[model samples]
Target: MTSSDLCATLDESDALRLLRGGQFQLEGRLVDASNTTLRARLTLDGVTARCVYKPVRGERPLWDFPDGTLAGREVSAYLVSQATGWGLVPPTVLRDGPLGPGACQLWIDEPDDAEALVGFVPSDQLPPRWFPVAGARDEDGTAYALAHADDPRLAALAVLDAVINNADRKGGHVLRGPDDRVYGVDHGVSFHVEEKLRTVLWGWAGRPLPAEAVEVLRRLAGAVAGPLGAELAEHLTTAEIAELAGRVDRLVEQGRFPLPPQDWPAMPWPPI
Candidate 1:
C-alpha cells in the first residue's frame, strides 16, 4: 500500500482527523529501536509508558507494509492485539491525519531493544536458542518459549495469529513483560491467512510433539468451529479460513516440530 492509499476516505471516527500529530509531549528512555520506528520509555497523565514513533519518508512507503500513516498502523496493531490477545504488538498513543494526507501513531513502550528478525533469522536466535540456530536454553533443554503459553489467553493469540496469517511472529517481536509475561510487538504485517507460515517456532524440528502443545491446538480447533471461526470470517474469506484450519491440522498430524520452509526465496528485507 502507498501514501495515496491512505486518506480520510474510510468510515473511521473523527479520531482519524486528529491522528496526524502529537496530542501531548513525550519524554522517556530510548529503551530500544529500529531503522523504521523508535520506542522510548514514557510517562503521561500519571501513567507509565513505552512510546513508538515512526517518521514518514519518501514518495513510496519504505517497508512494502500497508500504506498507512504511522497512526493508522499503530491503531490497527493495538486493536487487533486486543481482539485476539496474542499480545504480539504495541499500544496506540495517538493518531491523526496530517497536512495533505499524512498521519502518525505514538507507541508508549517496547519490551526489548531488538528488531524483529527481518529475513533468514540467524541460527543463534532460532528456538531452544529461539530454531534452526542455537543460543539460550532451559533445564529441560527447551529454549524458554513465551511464558504466556500456559495461559489460555496466550494460546488463543498463537492460534488467532496463525489463522490471520501473521508473517512476522519472530523472537524479538515477542517481548518479556515486567510481570514476566510475554507481549508481541510490531504487527504491521498480519492477517493474510495464506501459506506465509514462516517462523522460528519450529526449532525443535523433527522432535516428537509435546503433550502440552497438543492441548493448545486441540482447544483452537474446537474454537474454530465456534466464535473464533465466525469472527475470522468477518475479516477473511472462507478459503482463507480453510487454509488456516489446514495449517493447524498439518501441525497436529506431523506429530513433530517441523523445520522452517526455506523453500521459497526468503521474505525480502524490509518486506516492502
Candidate 2:
C-alpha cells in the first residue's frame, strides 16, 4: 500500500496491535543513530508496513533518564500526540523484537520535493515560508543560519514538544510527509520530570498559540488526569506524569510559545 493509504486504513490501535503481534524481519541497521536502531518490515493479517525498531538492550544510558526506558518514552510521546488529537506522531508501540523489548515506530518516507535535510543555509538563501532558527559565522567567515520550514504543522509540533518536554528535536527528526504534513520522530529523550525541553522550533518563541492549538492544550490539561494519565503512568514515573499534567496546565494558561532555556543550548547538538 502507498504511505497515505496505510495511514488512512490503520488507526493508532490497529498499528499498535500490529507492532505487538506482527512478524518483523530485520532489514538493516540505521547506522546514523547514536544508539542501535533497525529498519524492519512488519507483516500481519495481509497488511505490510515498515518500522524503525529500537531495542532496550541497545539503548545508551543517559545521566538524566533511567536506563532502558527510551523505548517506553517513545511510546509515551505517541500517546500524548494522539491524545492531543493532532496525530503528530506516527503510530508507535512498545514490543519485543529481534533484539529485545523495544520501540517500533512507523517509518515515514520522504518525498522528492521535501525540504533539504541539511538545515544549514545562508540567511539570504532560505526557501519561501522557511524561518531561521539561529545563525552562526563559519570558521571560513561565511554566514549561515539553521532554519526550519515554516508551516502550521511545524507550529503544532512545537506545541507537542512543549507538552512532552522533548529534550531533542533536531532537524532530521522532522519528516516532511508526501501529504505536506510534518511528523516529529525520535522522541526517546522526553517526558522528564524536570525542565529539559530542547528543540529547533524556537522560531515560534513568545508568539501566542493559535486558538485551535490552545484549545488542544486546554483539552489535554483536563484529559491528563484521566485516560491519558493512566496510559502514561504505565510507561513514565508518577512524578513524570504529574509534571506532564503541570506542563499542560501551564502551556494552556500561557497560551504562547516558550523560549529557550538560559542554562542549556535551546537546540540539540548537530542540529540536523
Tell me how far the alpha carbon of residue 153 in candidate 2 is from the true structure, in angstroms, after superposition: 0.4
TM-score of each: 0.49, 0.94
Evaluated against the true structure, the overall lDDT of model 1 is: 0.43
Per-residue CA lDDT of candidate 1, range 228-268, in tens?
66765544457655765676677677766554457642232
- Per-model lDDT: 0.43, 0.88
Q: Where does candidate 1 stray beyond 4 Å? A: 1-48, 51-164, 266-272
lDDT of candidate 2 over 35-88, digit per residue (tens):
899999889888888899999999998999999899999999999999989888
Best by lDDT: 2
